[model samples]
Target: MSRQRPRVLARAPGQPQALPASLHPVLRRVYAARGLAPEQLALDAARLQAPTALKQIDTASALLADAIVAQTPIVISGDYDADGATGVAVAVCGLRALGAGAVHYVVPDRFRMGYGLSPALAELAARSGAQLLITVDAGISSLEGVAHAQRLGLKVIVTDHHLPGSVLPSAEAIVNPNQPGCGFASKHLAGVGVMFYLLLATRAQLRAQNWFATRSEPNLAELLDLVAIGTVADVVRLDHNNRILVAQGLARIRAGRARPGVQALLQVAGRSAERLSATDLGFVLGPRINAAGRLEDIRSGIDCLLAADLQSALPMAQELERYNRERRAIETDMRETAELMIEDSDAAGICLFDESWHEGVVGLVASRIKERLHRPTFAFARAQEAGVLKGSGRSIAGLHLRDALAAIDAQAPGLILRYGGHAMAAGLSLAEARYEQFAQSFAALCAQWLDEDALQLQVHTDGELRGEEFSLDTARALEQGGPWGQGFPEPLFEGRFEVQSLRVLKELHVKYRLRSADGQSIEAMHFNGIEQLRERGSLHATYRLAINRWQGSESLELQLLDVLD
Candidate 1:
C-alpha cells in the first residue's frame, strides 16, 4: 500500500438497503456525503434559485447604467484562467448589448503578468483609453493597482470572488460575496458567477431607468451557459445558487439554444452542446480553457467565448485544442521527471528542482505528484524572466499548504520572497539559492500538522451501481443536478466487477470489459493502467459513472477512478 487507506464513514450501523423517493438506493449514501438533498436537486424549474436574494445587486445595476449613459471607456481586468476568460467574455457581451460604450478587456499574461491587478496591469489599462475599469474574476486585493488607476483618473468597479485582504481596494464599487459585511447568502460563487450577478444588476438598473422600455432586455440569462462552464472549470463549489445557474445553462444547451461560443468549445472538446453535462465542463472544457492560460495567453480562451459565429469559433477552438495537447505532453514529461527526483531524494518532504520544466504546466505537475506520492509536492521551473524561480505546490488535506509556506517566511524573516494561495493549492517565488531552506521549513511545518491519519488516501464512494441504473436517463438527471467541482463533487460509484477480458491497446493503456455480478456487462478503458492492472490481477473498482456514446449509440461506461486488487 502506498499509504494505508482510511475507513470512510459508513452508513449507520445497520441501515436500510433501500432508500425512499428520489435517490436510488445506491446513490443515497453518496448524495448524503456530497451535501445534497433530494428536494434540492429536483429537475423542475421551480427548484432553481433566484439571484435577487443577493444584496447590493441594485448598486451594481446603477454603476452599469451610469457607465452606459456616460459613454465611459470601460476596461475589464481578468485573471489568466478559463473562468477569468469566461467572466471577461460575459462582461463584454452583456455590456455591449446593454449599450455600454467602447468596452475593452485585458487578461494577465501568465508569463509576463503574475496574477490579479498589479501596477503593471494598471499601466497597460491606462494606455487603453479606459476611464472606468471593471474587474472580472480578479481585483479584490489590488490595493496598489486600484490606487494607481485612481491616480491616473480611472474610476474602478470591481466584481470578483477571491477572498479579500484585510483592506479592500478603494474602488468606486466592489461586488464580492467574500468581502467583509456583504450579506450575500451564497458564498460559493465563482469569478464568472460574480460577473453574472453584475449582469443581473445591470438589467435591473436599465429597467428602473426605462433603458429597456423600447429596447429589449438583451436576454442576459442566455449567457449563463458561459457562466456555468467557467464556474465549474474554476472549481467553484456547486451550491444551490450555482446549481441553478448550471442547471439552467445545461437546459438551454439540451434545448439547442446555447451560445455559439459554447457550442464551438463543445465541438473542440469532442462533446456536443446538445448533450452537455456537468462532467463535460469539469473534465473536458475546463482543461482546454485552462491549457490556454497555462501555455499561452488566456485571451484565446476569452476569444473563443466571445466569438459571434460558429465558423469563427472553429479555428480558435482548434488552436486551444493544440495548446491543450502540448500542455498534456509537457505535464507527462515533467511528472515522470519529478517522480524520479522524489524517489532519489531521502528528504522528508518533496521539492523537485528542475530548471528546464515548463513554468506554465508546473502547477499541474505538482498536483499529480502530490496525489500519487501522498505527500506535498512542489514543482519548480525556470522563469523566462531573469532572476526569478517560479514554484507551484499542491498539498494533501489537513496540511494548510499556504500557511506552511507563510510560516517558512515568518521563521527566517524574509526567507520566502513572495507567495499567495489557499489551503489546497499555492504558488510562490524565491531566489534559486534559498530553495533548500524553504523546503526544510515547509517540511518542518508539515511534520507538525500531519499524523498517520493524514497520510492515508481515502476515496469516499457511493457504492455498487448497475448498468441499467447508469442509463442515459439517469445520467441526464445527474447531469442537470451539477456544476460540480472543488467543494461539490460529481458523483462517484463503486462496483464489484469481474474482468471478462483485457486488451493491451498500447503497453500503457488497457481496453477492458467487465461484468457486474448482476450480469451487467460494460466496455471500459482504463487509461495508462496496464501495468497496475497486470500486477493487481482482475479487479474490484470504484469509478465515476457516465453514458459514453460512439457513433450515435449510447450506453453506460465507467470513467476509471480507484481500483483495488
Candidate 2:
C-alpha cells in the first residue's frame, strides 16, 4: 500500500499579538493560533475556575464535610480505567488527609459488575457498612444505580464528567461540570479533576466550620499528581482550567514531591522525575496504570497509585509493566488480524469482531485501526452476557462516535442495548446477532452525517519554522510552553527537506537524516512506516520538534508525522 499524504493547513497567527517581544516568534504564532495570550500561557492554580462555580459543588462539599464530622463510613465507587483509578486514589487520599473517618474505595471489575455505581455495586458497598457513596468517572446517567443506592440507605454523591442524559440521577448531590445549568468556566475537566475540586471545596467548608482549628489543614496540592495523570490518561481536552491542574501536577513531580506510586512508575518507565512532562504522564505512566485495568483488575492500579512508599509501589509498578506487556501482545495479534479482516467495502465506518478477542483490549485495537485507516472504527468482543457483544469505538475529527451510536439507536430502536461516550470515543453493547445490522445502520448514519471532505484526512500545522528557529533552544522553549494534550495539541510544523540519509530501523521504524533548505541537518523518525513511505528525493513532511535524550545528554530531533514526496 502507498502512503497517502494528508492535506496540510497552517493555522493563522494570533491577531494584534500581545505576546512578549522576547518570546520565540515561531512559538508566539503557534500559541496565538491556540487562542492563548502571553499571560494566559502561564499555568497557575489561580487560573483554575473557582470550585463553587460548578453546579451543586457547595452542597456536595457540605454533605462530605458533614459526613466526615459525623464519622460516616464513605465508599468511593470507581470505573475501570486510569481516570477512575486516579479518581478513587485522589478521593481516598484527599478525604483521609481531611480527617474523614473510614474512607474506602471499590473499583468495579469490568467482567463482573460492569461500569459505574450499579445496583449490585451499591449492595456490595452497603455490605461494607458504607453510609455515603461517592462515584468517580461515572454515575451521571446511572438512575437505576443511584436509586438502588438510596434504597440501600446510602447517600450518593455523583462526581462525574461525562455528558448527562435528559433525566439526571437522583443523587443527594451531583458535581459534574457538564451537568446542565453548570456555569463552570471549563466543562472539559477529567473525572480526577472533578474529584480534586470537590476535595478543595470540602477543605474550605471544614475550615469555615472551625473543623481544622486544631488540625493542620491538608494541602490539596499534594493530590494534583494523580489529577494530572488521570486528566491526560483519560484524554480529556486540556482546556485552560485542566492545563492548570496538569501543569501543577507536573511541577510537583519534577520537584520530587510525586506520590510514591507515581515515582515508582516513573522509575519503571525509565523517565526522569525532574524532566517529566505531559507526554511522559500521558504516554509513559498512564499506560502502566491503565494496563492493570485492561489486563487484570483496576483495583491493583488504584492500589498502586495509593501506595504510601517506594518499596510498596515498586512491586505494583512491576506488576503493571507485566500486564502492559501482555496487553501489547494481545493488541498486536488483534490489530494484524483486524487489518486482514477489512474488506473492499465502501462503508463510512468500520466494525470488526472476533469471539477470541479480549474485551479489555478491544479499545486499544480500535484506536490502532482508526489511526491506520483514518476511519471511525469499532472493535467488538464477546461479553459475559449470553448472546451479547461489547463494542468500543474511536472516531475521527469530523464524526462524533457516541452521537453516531445514538443515531443508529434512534433509527432502529433496540438495536443498541446500551451506550455512552465522548465525541472521539464510545462504548456500546448489543445482541451478538445484530452486529451486521448495527454495522449497516452505523454506516448509513456516518454516510448521512459525514461529507466526502470529512472522510479525507487532514493534518493541521502551525506553519514551517524558520531555519534559525530550528535549534535546541527553540525546541526546549516549545516544551516549556505546554501541558499540551487532546484539544490543546502540541505544535506540528511542515516543511520540505532533502533526504541526507535514510534507512529502516529494527524492521519497523523509518529513520532518516534530513537537511533543511538552509543546510541545517536534523535526525527524524517515523514509526511503523519503513516500507510504506520510502522516498528517494526531497519531500514535504509534517513534524514536531522533540528532545532526543540519551545517556543524560539531550539534542533536537524531529518526529515525522506525515510525508509527501
Candidate 3:
C-alpha cells in the first residue's frame, strides 16, 4: 500500500502560570502544550482518585469481603490478554493476601472459547466449584454469560473497563468507571487498574470490620507493579490517575521490589530493573505476556506473574519469550499479506481476511494496517466454527470503533454476533458469507463520520529544541517527565537538519549523523525509513530526544518519527 506523508504540526503552547518555576524550561513547554497543571506533575500514589467514586464499588467490595469471610470458593474469569492476565494475577494475589481461600481463575482459550466471558467460559468457571465469579478485563457486554453464571448458582461481579452495551448485565455487582452513573474522575483506568481499585476498596471494607485484627493487613501497594504492566499493556489513556498508577509501579520495579515474575521477565529481556520505565512495560514485558495468549495459552503467562520466586518464574518467562518470537514471525507474514491485499484498495475503512491468518495475530495486523493507511482497519481469521470469522479492529482518531460496530449491527440485525471494546480498538465475530456486506457498511460509515482532514494523518510536535537544549540532561529530563502514553503523549520536537552522513541498517532502518543549525552533530535513527530518505541531504525531521546507552556509555539520540521535504 502507498504510504501518505503525515502533516507535521506544532502544538499550541499552554499558559504556564500555574506551573512550578523550578521546572525545566523545555519540560515545562512540553507540559504546557499538554495543558498539564502543576498538581498533575505529582504522580505519587496519594494523588490517585478514590475508588469510592467508581459506581457500585462499595457493593462490589462488600460482596468480595463477604465471600472472604464466608470462605467461599472464588473463581476469577479473566480474558486472554496482557491486561487480563495481569489483572488475574493482581486479583488472585491480593485476595490471597487479604485472607481469601480457594482462589482459582479460568482464562478462555482464544481459539476454542473466543474472547470475553462466553457461556462456555461461564460453564467452565462454574465447574471450579466456586460460588462467586468475578470477571477481569471483560464481561461488560457478556449479557448471556452473566445470566448463565447466575443461573448456575454463582454470584458474578463484573469488573471491566470497556464501554457497556445498551442493556447492562444483571451481575451481582458491576464496577466499571465507564458504566452509566459512574462519577469517577478518570474513566481511562485499564482493566487491571479497575481490579486494583476493587482490591483497595475490599481491603478498606475488611479494615472497617476489624477483619485484620487476627491477621496481618496486606499492603495493596505491592500490586502496583502488576497494575502498571497491565495499564500500559492495555494502551489505555494515561490520565493523571493512570500516570500515578504507572509512576508508582515503575518506582516499585526500579527499587527491586517488583514481583518475581516481573523481574524474571525483565531479566529475560535484558532490561535493568534500576532503569525500568513505563515504555519497557509496554514494549518489553507486555508483549511477552501477550504472546502467550496470542499464540498459545495465557495461563502460563499468569502462572509466571503468580510465581512466588524468580527460580520458578524464569523458565516460564523464557517460554513466553519463545512464544513472542513465534508470534512476531506469524504477525510479520500476516502483515505482509495484508499490505499486499490493500495495495490497490481505496476503502475508507479497510477489512482484510485470510483463512490462513492466526486469530490472535489479527489485531496486530489491523493495527499495522491502520498506521500504514491512516484509516480504520479490521483483520479477520477463520474461527474454529465453520463459516465464522473472528476479527479485530483498530481505529483512527475521531472514530469510535465499538460505536461504529453498534451502528452496523443496528442497521443490520444479527450481522455482528458479538462486539465490545473502547473507542480505539475492539473485537467481534461474524459469518464469512457476510464479510463483503460488513466491509462495505463499515467503509460507508467511515466515509460519513470522518472528514478529509480527519482522514489525513497529522504528526503533532512540540516545535523545536534550542541548540543548548540538545543534551543528555535534556533527554533524561524528558524521559523522567512522563509515564506518557495514549492521551498524554511524550514530547516530540521538529527541526531541519543537515545530513552529515547516513547509513542503512538491515536494509530498512536509516541511521544518520545530522548537524543542527548551531553546527552541533547529533546521532539519529529512523526505523523503516530507508525508502523515505531517498538520499536526501537535508530534511525536516520530527523526533524525540532519547538517551541511548551503548557499551558502558550514554549519549543523546534522536528517534525520528517523520522526515519531510
Candidate 4:
C-alpha cells in the first residue's frame, strides 16, 4: 500500500569493527550498516540489564511476595491488546508457579468497560474478593482508576510501558522505564516483558527470604516463549536487551518447548513451531491472539494461552481462527471504504468516520489508510454512547500523533475528551458533532508541523547483493542473525533485476521471476500491489531475503517491499 519508490541508498556502516571471519560477509556488512557493534551481535541473556535497576521494581516485587506469604487474593488486570493478554497470562502462570495463592485475572472488554484498570473493573475485582490489584501493560495514566482501587481497599501495583502524563498515578508501586526518574536502560520492554521482570524480582525476593526452602524455585525463564510472542506482537522497538529476550524465547519455541496454546495457534496458522522465526510470531500467531481481543472477549485468547495441552487449547485456537477470519473480512471492507475517502481528500493528514464502521476495527483501518497514503490518519466509528465517536490514529515517521493531539487539545480545550498513545499510534474520543472541526484542526496542525520532504514516502535499502549472498543458506543465516523488528530492522536489499516473467495472483498480488545480472533466478512476490508495477525493462526493486515453504520443502525468495521502473 505504500507509495514509496526505492531510494536505494547504501547504508553507512557505523563505527567500524572486524566481524568474525566465519560470519557471512553480507551479514557482517548488513549488521555493521545497521549500527550493530561486534559485541552486540551475541544475544546472551546475561547481557540484559538487571530488573532491579528499574525504578520501584524491587518494591513491587516485595509487595507481591508479601501478598503470596499472606495468601491474599490477587487479581491481574490487563489491557485488551496482545501485550496485555500475554502479560496477564505470564503473570498468572508465573506467580502461581512461584506459589502465589488465589491468583486470578480480569481483562476489560474493549467495547464495554473500555481500556485499563477502570473503576468498573476494580469493582468487579472487588466482587471477586481480590485483596491486591496488579495492572499489566496499563494503569500508568490511570489516575482516577488507581484512586478508585485505593478507595475500594485494594493495594495496587502498576506495570506499564506507554508514555506517562505530567502527573503520575497514586499507586503503592509503579514500575515503568519510561516514567520520569527511572533508569531502566531499555525503555522498549513490552507489557509482558515488564511482567516477566517482576516475576524474576519476586522469585529473587522469595529466595532471599528462604521461601523456597521446602519447595523448588520456579524457573522464570520458561515463560520466555510467551514473552517473545507478546513482545513481537506489541510492535515495540527491539533493542539489544529486547533482542536477548526475543532470542531466548524464540530458542525455546524452536526447540519444541513452546506452550500448548502457542503450538495450537501456530497449528491453526499452518506455521511450524520447530522452525519458528520472529516474523512468524508477529504475522501468524500474534494476529490470531489479537483477533479475539478485536472481535470478541480477550478472555478467550488468555484461556488459550492458559490451557494445559494442545488438545485442550485446540477449541479456543479454532475459535480464535474463526474470529480472525471474521476480523479479516471486516478489515477488508473497512479498508476499501477508507481508501475511497483517502483518494478524495487533499488534507496533509486524514481523518475519516462512518457510522456503520465497527468500533473494534477502526485501529486496523487507520493503519491501512496510513500505509496507503503515508499520512497521519485517523479512522472513527460510532461509540456506544450517543453523540460520541471513538477514533484510532496511526502516524508516519516524521509526525508524532500523540504529541500533535496533545498540542491541539492544549490550543483548543475540550476538542479531545480522552486520548493517549505512543508516537506512531494514538486514540481519542470526541463529540460526533465536532468531527469536521477536529479534522480541520488536526490537518492544519500536521501541515504546520510537517515539511514537504517529511511527507514524501522514502524506502531505505542496503544496496545490491552478490549472487552468492542470495542463497537459501544466506537467507537462513540472515534470519538467524538476530530477532529483528520495529527499530532493529530486518535487512532490505535493493538492486536492478530483469523481469524474466510476471503474472498476477488473486487479482491483487504480483508474482514474478527476477534474474540478477549474474543470472541468478529467484521467485518474488508483491502482495496487494499489482496495480503499482508497469511492465518495463530492468527495474530497481527493494526486497527482504526470505524463505518460502511448500510441500514440505523450503526455497529462497524475495519479499518485495517496493519497485521503481
Q: Which has the greatest lDDT?
A: 3
Q: In model 2, which range of ten residues has the least summed lDDT?
A: 1-10
The residue pairs that clash in candidate 1, if any, are none
TM-score head-to-head 2 vs 3, winner: 3
Candidate 4: pairs in clash? none
Model 1 stretches with alpha carbons more than 4 Å out: 1-29, 43-57, 344-349, 465-483, 518-522, 534-538
- Flag regions of model 2 displaced more than 4 Å: 1-4
**What lDDT score is found at residue 384 in candidate 3?**
89
lDDT of 4: 0.88
Predicted candidate 2 versus true structure: per-residue lDDT over 1-565, tens digit per residue:
1223577888777653687767877778778888886667778888788998999999999999999989899999998988999999999999999999998887777877777888898888888898999999999988999999999899999999999988999999999999989999899999999999999999999999999988999889999999999999999988888999999999999999999999998888777899888988888988889898888798888898899999999999989988988988999999888877874555778899999999999999989878776778899999989999999999998898888888888888998999999899999999999999998888778888889888877878998887688999889989998888888899999999898888897888898899988899989988876655656778788899988998889988999987755
What is candidate 4's lDDT per residue for 355-432, written digit by digit as tens? 889998999999987877778999999888889899999999888899999999999999899899989999999999
Q: Per-residue CA lDDT of candidate 1, range 267-320, in tens?
A: 877777776677677778878888899998889888888888999988998898
Task: Mark the regions of model 3 whose C-alpha exceeds 4 Å error after superposition.
Answer: 534-536
Give the distance in Å from residue 406's predicted Cα in candidate 1 to where it truly belongs. 2.6
Best-first order by TM-score:
3, 2, 4, 1
Of 1 and 2, the candidate ahead on TM-score is 2
Better of 1 and 4 by TM-score: 4
Clashes (backbone N, CA, C under 3 Å), per candidate, total: 0, 0, 0, 0
Instruction: Please give the lDDT score at residue 34 for candidate 4.
Output: 82
| Candidate 4, superposed: residue stretches over 4 Å from native | 1-8
